[model samples]
Target chain A: MRTLVDGQPGTVVPVDDRAFLYGESLFETVAFRDRQAPLWSRHMARLDLGCRSLGFQPPRPEQLLAECRKVLPESGPAIARITITGGSGGRGYWPAPDAPERRVIQCRDWPGEIDRQRSAGLRLTISKSRLESGPVGEGLKHGNRLVQVMAARECARSGHDEAVLLDQAGSIVEAISSNILLVVDDQLMTHPRPVVSGVGLGWLIDQPGLDLRLRPVAGEDLARCSEVLVINSVSGVRPAIAIEQYRFRPGPTCRHLQSLWNEQLI
Target chain B: MRTLVDGQPGTVVPVDDRAFLYGESLFETVAFRDRQAPLWSRHMARLDLGCRSLGFQPPRPEQLLAECRKVLPESGPAIARITITGGSGGRGYWPAPDAPERRVIQCRDWPGEIDRQRSAGLRLTISKSRLESGPVGEGLKHGNRLVQVMAARECARSGHDEAVLLDQAGSIVEAISSNILLVVDDQLMTHPRPVVSGVGLGWLIDQPGLDLRLRPVAGEDLARCSEVLVINSVSGVRPAIAIEQYRFRPGPTCRHLQSLWNEQLI
Candidate 1:
């Protein structure tokens, strides 16, 4: 992977960085094709929202784009991840008033098998760990993601491709990393809270031609779905073939959305 | 400040570290005096508990102690902070199964005025941000501390020395960085849950001669308290002069505990 710290090539960040000590950071993952991150605007929008929620100045989109372009490969599928931290501060949780924001952009080769997972579908397990709600940056892709990390670890341990997370009330929240979509009665339904939704899902919802409804999803509601799909910027859309014991075939809605998502890559 | 990363002198950590990426880390701050960190054992106990909760191997206490000794000043009051991260990992929350643990030990000059604050007392304000419960590592000093960061920011903005936090149910949790104690009817009381209590408070409770009771404390209960104190490894014990509109006086109980805490420094 190639990395740029504050637009300069480097991999190390100061230990006193608030992100390092207190998880005071936000990140966005953008998929790059032919050296351009097509979803850059959507990622930046979410990053800007995150900065606003955390009370930090958002980095200029053009500068972030330039940094992403610098690290991305010239002509292949890659993932560009941008991390913005509250920068280095003294030994405490209170951020220095003048602390500069540190941005790290890293480009890595996209997993080739993600395409296969996208087409063939993934086996999903219901995670034992649940995401906690009521935090200030609930839906934002902020750095304090220990819950997701633990859930992903469970997925890996259970040999499932992904883990489905629920909120404290046992309502479906999202997948470990992606936003979840359910085709219930041939209508696309998703949870509406932007605070908890990912940028990729936000983009998917805004795209033309899909009839989408936003509402809370209960576990029983997921069982009633005709199809289940996970969406993220890096993988676009991936069908979930199985969640626990319930099995799903990639329905027409899943295929249509996948096609819609893939169209942007070209 | 002087730092030792993985037992070597350094100030920067890899950006890809799980701690940096996902707040997959734990830390303990030990107060050092006369070239010895008297609270090292207590810190290690909490660190080990955190590791157990997070499913990582705890570092050997002797090695951590040796490293702490290296960074601490030869003879003076200082603070030694030990941070253990899940080390460097690939571009995802799922940590590499074999990822090595990274330990960072940092030594800094102790705040000279904390002693005065302990004696004269601190002005405390009730924080607007509330701590969420039900996370796996709730009480552990794991690195995912955005809530504390936000509360501390509020304290700084309100011009208060500290902010008192409440759980989702409006029960007292702790201050931004320290555990709270209330002398109710001349009996010391604190919340019992390990998930919300600080290591400093844990040590205080274990100290001989102080009668400490563990129970949930409501905001209304603070109004009935004879005295209120906050304890952390860095400052030992500090009296809280106020919490919102409720005022407190540093009673004899506060003085006795402070003396018990200071006795260890000698």
Candidate 2:
């Protein structure tokens, strides 16, 4: 993997960086091919909105792209992660108003297993852990992800590819690292809030010939869906074979969505 | 400020450190006077339990203390922070089972404002943010503190010393950085779970001649309490002057607890 911290080639960050101390940061993971990030706009839009909401000065798109290009491969598939953090400061949760934003762009080879899992379908389990509700930065892709880390550990222990997380009210929110999508009555649906809104899902929803609706998926509602899909920027679209007891097979809609997602990566 | 990463004097951490990436870490803040950390044992007990729960190898007490001593002042009050992270690794949330834990010990001057607040009493406000519910590491002092960070920002904006956060069900959990204490009917009451089990509060409860009860505090219960306080290792005890509309004054019980806390600090 290669990294650039604020355009400097380094992997170390100051201990006082608020991201390291209080998870005061926002991040985006984009899948790129031939040094081009197809979802760059979507990722940046989210990052810009997050920076404004969190009170950090948003990075300029031109400079950020230049930094990202420095870390990308010449002509192959890779993953680019852009992290914007409240820069190093004194000991406190309230960020200093004058503190600059620390931008770190990292590039790594796309894991081959994601492709295998995408093709073979994923074995998923519902996690026992629940997420916090309401509009408290839940839709932002921020650094405070201990809940997802624990849920992923649970999936790894259970020999499952992914784990589904629910809110305290038993409403299905998302997967460990992806957005939850349901194909109900031949229409695609997903949770509206209390989740990190996915860049990949947003792109897919914008594409022509797609029928999408935003709705909360209750625990019982999982059984009502014909197919359950997990979507993320790195792994475009993965069909879930089973979530504990409920079983599913990759259907025509799943194939159609995968084709649409694949076409853009090229 | 002075820092020792793995016992080496440094202020930078690798970008891949899980604590920086996924908030996959636990931390403790200790207030030391003349090189003596009064709540070291309690902090270590909490860290050990958190490591076991989250699957990290907990650092031994002796080595941790030695590193902390390297950065402490010889004769004045200072704040020491011990951070244990899932050390540098590949791009993923699930930590490697054999991955080594990273220990970071840092010391800084104790903020004098805490002393003023403890004496003058604190203006508190109820935060709009609600915490996640259930037994998902709510009582642990881990690095996943974005919710607290945002709530602290709210307090700063509203000109309050601290902000009280409730759980999704409107049950009072804790303040941004301290545990909540309610002096109700001549007895001290605090939430049993859904709050960072505080070392300072623990010591106060364990001391002689104090009545304590572990119970949930609903939003409505705020009016019933005659006094409200915030307790933490760094600040000891701070009486709340007000929480939104409900008013409180430093009463006899608050003074008694402060006296007991002060006796040990010396």
Candidate 3:
């Protein structure tokens, strides 16, 4: 893991940084390829949207992009994270009426199974913990993530690759880190929600003959699906082999999202 | 503001630090008296409780005390902050099982008119935003704070000194930063929900004469109060002079809490 602070290489943060104090910040994850972040634009757009939605001004894009260029080695796939915060303050929730301090970070060597899993598939667990629902803050990767953190812990404890999260109202939102898309017969239908549906799922929907379905998907509906794919930037689109005993054979729709993702990124 | 990273005088937080990524952390705000912090023990206890709740193997108590000693050099009240996180190999939210990274930070300053105003009074605006109410991660000053951040922003925009928050069910919680207490004639009262009665508020209640009346304090009920005080660690206690059009002068209860608070800290 490497971090560049205000354009120079460094570590540690301000004591009063509101990100740590209040979780008053926004963050994004991007896929790095050959010394460059492939989905940098998408990640930044989402970050910008989140900051605005929550009322914040992030660091200038060029400054962030330049810093990212310095840290990302000309190499294989890795994860690049950008966090912009309202900076440190006293024991008050009101932000200092000024520009927030920005924190951009990148972590190297994760899983080492990106290509292997893309070729094979992943197994998911239906998490008892639910993703937050409502219009105020759904979808974007804001800093307050107690629910997702719990769900991830649950998946690791249960010996599963990931967990599928339903909203508080019992509607499928997304997996812990990836979006869930089901393939039935030839249709690529995914649970639609008022919450997050970011670039990865949007790209998957754009694939030809994918037959994207946007409706409520309950955990009970998994038994009727022939194939399922969990989507995220790091993992692209991987088929779901089993969701707790119900097995899914990898289908062509899964392969199609993969090929389209490759074409889009590489 | 002066920042020293591991005794070096400057500002730059390491990017790989877990507090930046996972929001896995805790902090303590010790109110400064001439050259030392008042109620340091209570603050330390709350920080420890937060660590215990977050499941972070607590750090050496002496080390944190030493960090505070190293930072304070003057005779003015200030806020001392400490953060501990499990990071490196940074899985974003999924802390690496057993990585312990702690950062202790101290800020030297108090807000404007905090002491003087506590002697006089304050005005509070009831916020429409609701604090996330639950046992999963409630009350601990962990970083899941977008909820409070939004409420704080509205407080600033609305031109109010503080904002009273409620739960999803319209139950009164606390001010954005302080524990709320309303006095009707003689008996003192406040809402006793854990989400609002964080460690700071809990300690404030144990003081004699300032008996805590546990009841649901609604928006309608607040207007009928003869005196109100927004209490917290740093501020101690400040009488509520006005809320919208409703007003109250500093009375016996507010004066008693203020004197008791001064005796305890200043």
Candidate 4:
């Protein structure tokens, strides 16, 4: 992988960096095709909001875009991750007001199996661990993600492709790494709260042709859904084949959405 | 400060270390004096429990102790922090089963004003940011400490010595970096739930001479308190002079406890 730290080439981060020390950081994983990130603006919006919430100076969008462009593959599909840390500081939780921000841009090969998973559908399971809504930085993708890490570990342990997470109220929040959408009686239904919001889901929701509505989704609501889908920036869209004992066939709606995402966005 | 990573000298951590990537790690801040950590065993117990909860193999206590010893000053007061990360791994939240645990032992100068703070008492305020008890790892000192970080930020912004946090149920949880105790109606009360358990509080509770009792402490209960104190491994015991508009004097109980702590433990 090609990596840059604050636009300089490096692989080592300071031990006292706030991101490493106190998890004071934000990141965006953008999928790049032909040297262009489709949802760069949306990713920047979220990153900027996260930076402000975490009390760090947001990086300029042009500079971030330039750094991402520098790391993107010459002409192939690649995933570029931009991590902006609150920067190195003293051995304490209270961040220095003037601490400089550290930005890391790294480009790696896109997951080769994304297409296969999108076409054949993914196997998913419900996670026993529930997401706790904090007073701040709830929807934004900040670095403190042990809950998601634990949920992903559960998915791996259960031998499933992904895991669905619920909030403390047992309301369906999102997938471990992506946002979830369900089709019930031909209406697209998703959880109203963007708890663990996904950049890909934001982009997909803006698409003109999709029938999308936000509603509180419970386990019973999921059971009534005809199709289940997950979306993230790196993996544009994938259908869930099974959630526990319920199995779903790859549907035409998902295929059409994937095609639209690739043709117009990618 | 002196530093070691996995028992070797190091000042840099890998960018992809799970601790840095997803906050998938646990840590302990231990107080050391005269070449000894007073609450070493208690810290190790908590760390081990956290490791188990996070699905990482716990480090041998003997090895961790030895590392801490290596960084301690020959014969002075110091603070040693033991950070056990899930180590480096491939680009995902689900940690590799064989991922090596990374232990970082760093010794730094003990806060010089701790004694002064203890004698004069601390100015504390209730934090607006409430701690959400998670389904798992609620009491563990995991690396995902954004909640505490935000609380500390609140304290800094409000110009208070520390912030007392409450859980979702409006029960007092802990201070930003320590556990809290209140004396109400001549009865020593602390929150029953170890929401943010501290090694110092655990040690103090086990001491035979203390009149500590665990009960759910509410906001109204705090108003009826005669004395409030915060305890942490680094800052043995310090009285809270004020919480919002409520004023508290440096009571004899806190002074007596401090004397006992210094004489018997520290």
Write the residue-wise lDDT of candidate 4 on B74-118 in tens digits.
898988878888898755777887888888888878887798998
Candidates 2 and 3 compared: the better one by DockQ is 2
Which residue runs does candidate 1 get wrong by more than 4 Å? B194-196
Residue A182 lDDT, candidate 3, scale 0-100: 75
Q: Give the per-residue lDDT of model 2 (tens digit) for B135-165.
A: 3676888887778888877788898888999
Model 2 TM-score is: 0.94
For model 1, report the TM-score of its A chain.
0.95
Give the poorly placed runs of model 4, Cα more than 4 Å off. none
Of 2 and 4, the candidate ahead on TM-score is 4
**Between 1 and 4, whose TM-score is larger?**
4
Candidate 4 lDDT at B27 equals 86
Q: Under CAPRI classification, how is model 2 graded?
A: medium
* Candidate 3, B92-189: lDDT as tens digits: 55656666555556665677778677776777787877665642466676666676778778888888888888767666678877888888656688
Top candidate, metric DockQ: 1
Off by over 4 Å in 2: A218-225, B218-224
For model 3 the local lDDT of residue B45 reads 72
Candidate 1 local lDDT, A1-266, one digit each (tens): 49999988999998888888889999988888887777778788888999988878999999988888888888988888899999987448888977889999988788877979988999999998877775578678899988888888878989998988887777777898888998888788887763356777878778887789998788778778999999887888899999998899998988888878777754
Q: Candidate 2 lDDT (Cα, whole model)?
A: 0.84
> DockQ for each of the predicted structures, in order?
0.79, 0.62, 0.41, 0.77
Which structure is stronger by TM-score: 1 or 2? 1
- For candidate 3, give fnat to 2 decimals: 0.52
**Candidate 1 clash pair list:** A139-A195, A139-A196, B139-B195
